[model samples]
Structure formats: structure tokens, C-alpha cells
Target: MTKGLDLHFPHQTGFLSLTAAAVSHQFVNEAKNWTEAQSHCRSHYTDLATLYNTDDVNALTQLGSPTGSAWIGLYDDLIDSWRWSITNSSFYGPGETEFRNWNVPQEPNNAFGQELCAHMQSDGTWNDLPCASAFINFVCYGGNDQYVLINQGRTWNDAQSYCRANYIDLPSIRNATENEKVQVVANGNNVWIGLYRTRTWSDGSDSSFRHWNSSQPDNLNGQQHCTAMSFSDAGQWTDEDCATTLPFFCYIADRPTVVTLRAVVDAADELTEAEIEETILKPLREELIRNGLPNSTSLRLRKVYQTNP
Candidate 1:
């Protein structure tokens, strides 16, 4: 365990396996108020790390010692319910509100009339604390999938919104092969994907299902709250805290053929011969000329002879 922090771990039967995946980063509450703590978390580490589910919580618990509580990135004051600072949205998963393991007692009791901090105790339960109390340190998970790279940088929330606005769900992997493909493209950077435990799909619904790699999506820390793709590893999927501001991946869905054409012109049928010649043929001719095709090539017009009168 690191000095003042109580970092615990699960018992391993064989050689203790310690991969970058198992390491987690946390922040300490140092007399900083809510807003200040939020800023410190954002500026220092990734955003306040949000728990995905029970599995994620368990994994994080290993990082603690036998004593002391750790602060997480969950709070209810900004919104009506518990929300992640990374996405600034409510935490999604099976039994969101009823999950006692994550929350001690339907809290956000807004206790002290100003409770906005959460900590993990030695027993693995969560307790709400005053934001100004400087007794807690938080944890962070860093892996390849926590971040997304784009032409320009953006917040995880922005990345998620951009994917939803432009594509189907965030990018999803159908199998290990696809995951490997994504990893190759990602290189060493983390990217976002379309797999979250927001809700289960309906019976017979194909679009909502996720095919995780074998032995994957262990929901490591708590609930497998966030989704990321690993490149150094086997392009496998890993669950992470959403607030961990790592890079994210974004994708644009294939637009309908008609919509694509309309984007270039008002409508395909509305294009005039002159317009086509000016916009299409002229450009092609210029490109051909640039490529060494003869610009002066000409053809003789054929005429038909009249027979009568």
C-alpha cells in the first residue's frame, strides 16, 4: 500500500499477476472543497473516475490497504442523482439505484446539507463525506481504452456525444478479431467504444448485444462502467471508470446513399447538364490533363446525308 493509502488486492492462487490493467490511481481529499476538488481531479489525473459496476469496485478495492477510505468521482448535487464527472451524466447499469455495494444507503443524503464526496472503507462499502473534509484519497485506472484520439482533442463526454450524433452507438467490437483490428489502428492510444452497461437489450434485439473477447469484460473494478480497447494487449475490451479522461475513439456511420448525395447537391435529379459538366467533367479533365493526358484531343462530328428534296 502507498504510504497513507490502503491499497488491497484479491488473493492470487498462482504467481501474482500485476499488469498495467490492475493498477489504479486515486486522489486525496486535502481540505479542498467540492469545486476545488473537482478541478484538482480534472487538472491532475483524468476526470474523477466513476465506478462502472460491482466488478470494477472489487478490482479497485484491491488497491486499498486494510484501512482508510478512497474518494470516487460520483456525486448527486450537480444533478438529481449520482452522476459521473467525466460524462456529467447519471451512472448507468443494472440495479443502478438499488446496488447497495456501490452506495451505502441510498445516499447523497445531501448530508451535512452539503455532502458531495464518497469514500471506500476497509469493508468495501461506500460512505458519503463532506466535500471539504481532507481525509480521503481517490483512485484512477489507466489503460489503452480510457481515451480516444481525434483530429482534435475532446472530453470523454464530448467524444461520446460526437459518436452518438454522427454514428450508431459508439464503435462496438463484434469479436476478438474486430477488437484486434481496432487495437492495431489505435496503436498505443486509448479509444472509446459503444459498450456500456446502461441497459440490457430486449429479447431478440440484435443491435444492443456486445461480443466481448474471451475472459473479457470482467467488470474489473466495479461494474465495467466504461468501455475501452487495448492495443498493447490483445485488443481486448476492459471496463473502466468513465471519469478517467483517457483518450476516446469516435466513428462516423455510413450515411444513406441519398443522404450522401444530397450533402453534395440539393438532389441528384436537380443537377443540370451544365452543372454536371462544370462540376464533374471539367474537374476530371483537369485531373487527366495534370496526369499527362492530351488536353487538345478532339473528335470529328459525324453528319447524316439527307436523301429526298
Candidate 2:
């Protein structure tokens, strides 16, 4: 539904049809904290580098040959990170998705940053733990308040897959009543719930691709929430403290662009098309420059057609 940036003037509306910008990585040898590096990237180029696959990872390795690790865009979202495997928002009611019954102060402590998934205790209170390490019995909800507790053990992801294939999904404890029902299914043992969290990127990209080093993202001391790719480690990723200053990589779109805009204008019969283009291009160019488009970057209005709204 949405195209590129749309520009609006007092008597004119313009639709910016931007050809995709070819993204590239840039390495900054200067050391700075994760937040500071992000600010620098936004000010100078695009946001921090976000790798989606091995190809993208390999591309960053070719940048200015250097040593030491550098920050990328990935980071652990410590707040409001828990989510259900059944991601359909319609499955939940008002305040239902936000419901949590953790065992409190010590439960989701993320001890060493390894506890990204949650399981329910015998008492119905939840605790976060490593999803893969714990192969435990899981509960599956089959709608209409039906909960099935399977005796077989499986990892959280596996359980989610199994439940999705067989039932609705892994159980979602929306309230104490639902919790009690699911807790009863547990029959006095910890069982996997649908609650889990995942890290995010600075540019808000939702690519699930990950290339962490062995046993990385350990969230050491619970302070390592930022991610960095170690050149010495074959561009593998690891989580570090957000405040730790380090050289970082930034991405910018370097390829040329040709924009086709559909503009509507109301003007005196004497006005020329060039004048209309100038008036619209001035603000459009300013917006582009303010958003980190290089000054030397070529910008031209390929075609401006008058269309009936």
C-alpha cells in the first residue's frame, strides 16, 4: 500500500517512486559505544549494519581490513520481549497478550542471558530457562479452552512445531484461570509454554537469520545485550555490553537512484513545468539530504505526470 516517501505541498501532492538503493557496508575504525556508533551511522550514512545471511556476513568482512570486533545492529530487547508462538493477535483478548505470572524477582533473571524461553513450574508460576537445554513435557492448547499435556519431552521450538502441526499451538496462559488450567495439565511438573523472546536489529528488520559463534550471546553477567562480529572469528557474532566502546560498521545505499513522481498541482496558467519541478524538488532534495543522502548523489525527476485524484 505504501510506496517511497510521499511529499505533500499546499496545492500539490507528489508520490516518490524510488528505485531500490543498493546497500553496502562501511567500517569505522574509531571506537564508540553501541549507541554512539548507531548515532554516527544515522548522521553519516544509513543505520548500523544488519546482516541477514552468510553472504551479508561475508560482505562485511571485505570492508577496510582491520582487527578486533565491531558492533552490528542486533541487540537483546530486555523489555516486553516475551511472545507467544501463536502470533495471531486475534487469538488474544484485551490485556491477554501482556499477561505474565513469573515466579517473581528471581524468575526471568536471564541468568547469564541464556534464558530466552519460559516454562511453568508445578505451582503455575513461570520461570525463564534455556529452551534447547531443557527437553521437557509441553502443553498444547486446542482452542475452546482445551489444553493437552503431552508426556513426551521436547525443546521449546520443537514443541511449538509439534503443537502447530497437531493442535492450535503451545499453550498461552492469558490469565490466572487459564494458568490454573494449564498448571493442572502439568500435574506437578514443569512444562513448556509458548512464552519466548528474541533479539532485534537496529534498523527494525525482521530477518531471523543468525550466525553466532559457538555458545555466544551468553549475555555474560546479564550485561551483554549488544552484538558484535569478530573478524578474528570469521565474522561470527557475539553479544557484549552496550556501553563497551568498539569500532563499528555502518551501511549506506551507494547505488544511483531514479525517482518517478506523480505530482498534482494547482497553479496559474502561466506557470511552467520546470517551475513546478523546482518548487517540489527543493523540499524533496532537502528531505533527502537531511536523511543522510550523500550531497554528491544524483537526484532527478524522471517524469512528473498530472493525475486525477
Candidate 3:
């Protein structure tokens, strides 16, 4: 074969690792509804926080805020529509967005088709309640997986803001063991968990990651449309209404997407450096674009001289 060329995707700011991408996050301590929060984030930064992965969710828990909850970029124009809080598509994988855990594993209901908000019940089960009902206590966790349960009650939206500003998004339970950890801190009270089904991102990204606290998304009262991260059982998702305005989350993203590449070739023709860049490396970039890669990225090239084998 001809001489080889290498490709790399570096960070926009600095020389991060080859596998790193550059993303920025900024938090707004102001209290606002979901609609209001998005407007503020878009105006000041990018938009209300969006989650690329569980890591993104965990990172927000580290922020510090005084309110019990705030608002996030996640919202649904359709009753049961769901999506990620952020607009990026690279963070999703197969069967990731569809992950869900319901108390009633057999036949689940949609909060009886009532409203659009969700909260955790005692024992970590979920229920669809009105989001605008009132504020309630919520649990906040950190990147190290440490958590603090807020005794004071706040609206679901309010709770989210508090956790994000102070810690991370509502507790994201991975298994029954982790759920037990949250249950102890719950103190026998039904607290909010991070699970819901509003099938549409405010930024218009699609995600199918669902973690219901069992018997969730029931659509009870036909009014619950929003969601809360429940803590009673483990950290399951619940449904609630948008108007209820419970303590909720306000998030910022710290996502980066950096890629690095290196190549080795048998130098028989001994082509010039420019020929390698134009004939070989240039095609690689074009192919990446054809595959629908983001065009706003900054690309660079590097050269190394080695004696032929």
C-alpha cells in the first residue's frame, strides 16, 4: 500500500486526550419554571442542561444551589413523548433510551392518563401526580455517589434545580442495591426519583432511557405529564403534570467529544507529505462528513518522519 496518513479530533479549547471531545457547561442560580429556565440558558449559555450520559447527570449533582428544585431542558409537547434533556445524539446507544423499571412489572399504567408529573412514593414505587400540586422534599446526590435528602418540600421543578445547583440530577439508581441505599436516607417518606416519560426534549433530541420506580408513567389523574426522580424504593421514575411546578432540576452539560487517530504505512512510492494529506487524509474527512458527523468541529494534522522498515 501507499504511505499512511493519520487523523485526529482535538478539543476546541486545549489538547485533551485523543478520546476526548470539548463541551462546556454553565449553571444559572436563578429560579424559573421550565419554560423560563430554557429561555435563560439559551440567552446566557447554550440551553437548559441536557444529559448526554449518566456521567452528565452525575456531574450536575455537584453544582451548588439553595432551592429544592429548578427547571431543565426536558419537556414534552405530547402527553407521553420522551427525549433526552440535551440535543446531542452521540450519547445514546441501543436499548439505552428504552431502559425502564416499574413496580408493576407485568401490566403498567400511565398514571391513569391523568396529568404530567412524577414523584417517588415510600418503598421506591412511582405514581403519576399533578406536577403543579406543590413542592416536596427531594434527594440530591454527588459524583462520588454520595447523597443528602432534603427534608423540606419543594415543587418537582424546584427540587431538580436545587439538586443540580447543589449536587447532581435526582438520584439515578442503577440496581436494587443502590435503591436500598436511597431507601435508608428516604426515612420512610416517598421522595422524588429520576424517572419519567415526556418523550420530547426541549432542545428536540430523542432518548429512550427510562427508569421507572415501578408502576410509573401511569398518567394518573390524566394530568401528570412531567416526571420526578423517586427515592422510596431505589431511584425509579414517576409521572406528574407540567403545571404542578414541583421542585425540579436545572442542569448544565460538561460533555466533550474528542477523537484521535494514528496510522502506519509501508512507504514504497515515497510520496510527498502534501500528497499524503490531499490524496489519503482528505478522503477520510470527507467520508466522516458523509457519515453525518458534525461539521462545526476543528480539525488539524500532524507529521512524523521515520526510516522505512
Candidate 4:
């Protein structure tokens, strides 16, 4: 719906129609803190990426290394306020978006300082980390339905830049099946998963789907606020500091579009009833064919006339 971007698909549920769309994701090889990472992505392509289904996670995993973890677009801005990538209040309820799979008792202790970035472990759990600590890989999501996983070691900010330049921004994971798919690909690496408190999608969609490990989101130590995926227990989650930088993933979207087009012809300018078909109706048919529309398509047109208004 924007410039230089078009949505194209044979058929899609609840969407627009266009000639075609160009959606995709990329993997960056830099690092920075969570905030910096997001900024980097916004400056270049769209924003941090967000996930929707199993296909999204699985596709991203295929592009990533089966070792390290990547950054996604999830964080815990509030102590107990959890949200998704999209900021639509009406889409999800209080308990609807609260999906966490922490490793329990040991994670989210806020061990260091202000942790606010989310990541995924190779195993597919989650954790919260500091936004400006050391360095970790990261990822970004954009476009229609797309994702990417990078295999670089940098701070969150650095990773964001790399993604923006090469791909989109960090990605967001939406459902459990998607989480599991990502887990299988992680292969025991601590990658980033798109989840956090007060979540919002890069494309601004409200899809409620969470897969936290067991006894997670402890928000321990009051400092641990960010989120991440874990490897120890089937891709669960844990709260950590955001300052700890890491690698990440990025993506773009070009989802299939479906549009309903209609035309309302004004019959007020018609001729006499006796001359109707010959003067107005028959020519309309010829005009459609002249315009290059398929004859079959035109033949399917339903004949309807406004009797009142």
C-alpha cells in the first residue's frame, strides 16, 4: 500500500488485491543494544520484525545457523506489563498475550541492570536481557509475511544496523508452533525471539500467541525485564538484561492480497425504455471487450439495475 511496494497474490483471506508484492527478510552480522538495534532497523527498512505462524519461524530458521541465537523485536517495558509486537488493545486481552516459557526461579532475576531485549535460545525457550550490556546477534522483520535470521556477533544496535542495510529489522515470534519450529533450528544456541511486555508488531498487527517455557517471566531482581528464547528446555524463555548485546534476525513481507472491486453505474443518463438495450446496454458489453478484459470475465458480470435510488 506504499510507494515502491505492491501486494500480489492469487488468493488470500482478508487482504487487499494488487499486481504483486515484494516481501522478504535478511540476516545481519552486527550487534548493538535493543534500543539501538531497533533504531538501526527503522532508519533503514521497516522496523523490528514480528512473527505470525509456524511457516514464518521455520522459514527463518532455515536461513540461520544451527548454533547461535539472534535478536527479535520483543521486550518488557513494564515489570508485569506484557504485550506483543502489535499495539492494538482490542485484539488481545489481559491474559491473552501473557505467553512465557521461562526456565523458572533462575531466570528473569534482573541480575544486572535494566534488561529489556528478547532473544531465542537454540532450544526455543525465551529470556529477557539487558539492552546495553555486551554483544549478541539480532534479527529484524518487515514487509508482508517474511523473516530472516542472522549469524553475527555484535551488540543489539550494531546488529540492527546490519539488518537495516542488508534486510529489514529484528523479527517477532507469534505462536507456539512457530516457536517450536524456531527451537528445532536453533540447535541449542540462544537466539532472539520476538516477544516482550507491552508488545507491538513491526507491521502493527495484533496477533496473540505466546510460548514461554515453564515458570518463566519471573521478572526477578526487578532489573531483569527483557525477553529471550532458551535452548535448555525446548525453546522456552527467560528474563535477562538488555545491555547484553547479541546477534539477531531481519525480514520483509509481501503477503498475498485479496480485494473486492465493485462498480456502480448511474442509470439516470439512460435513453428511453424502448432504446435501452441497443443504445446503453449492448455498447457497455462491447466497451468491456475493447478494454481487453477476457470475454468470459465479462460474461460473468451480473446484470442489475437500480429500481429506486
In terms of lDDT, the best-performing candidate is: 2
Model 1 segments more than 4 A misplaced: 1-24, 27-32, 78-309
Q: Would you estimate the TM-scores of all the predictions?
A: 0.20, 0.73, 0.37, 0.38
**Candidate 1 per-residue lDDT over residues 203-275, each given as its tens digit:** 1111212323466434443434444434333333454444444432211112211100111222323322323
Off by over 4 Å in 4: 1-22, 79-198, 230-237, 254-309
Best by TM-score: 2
Writing each residue's lDDT as its tens digit, candidate 4 over 1-309 gives 422212221221121122223446565657666666667667765655555444445555565556555556666555454434433334345555566766566565444434456677655667777645345555555435455556666655565456545554444455575566556555566765545434444444333345455666565666555555443344444555667675555555444342233334444432222133334434544564466532212221223334334
Candidate 4: residue 196 lDDT (0-100):
45
User: Per TM-score, what order, best first?
Assistant: 2, 4, 3, 1
What's the residue-level lDDT of 242 in candidate 3? 65
Better of 1 and 2 by TM-score: 2
Which pairs of residues collide in candidate 2? none
Q: Model 1 misses residue 97 by how many Å? A: 21
Each model's total of backbone clashes: 37, 0, 116, 125
Local error of candidate 4 at residue 164 (angstroms):
44
TM-score of 3: 0.37
lDDT of 1: 0.35
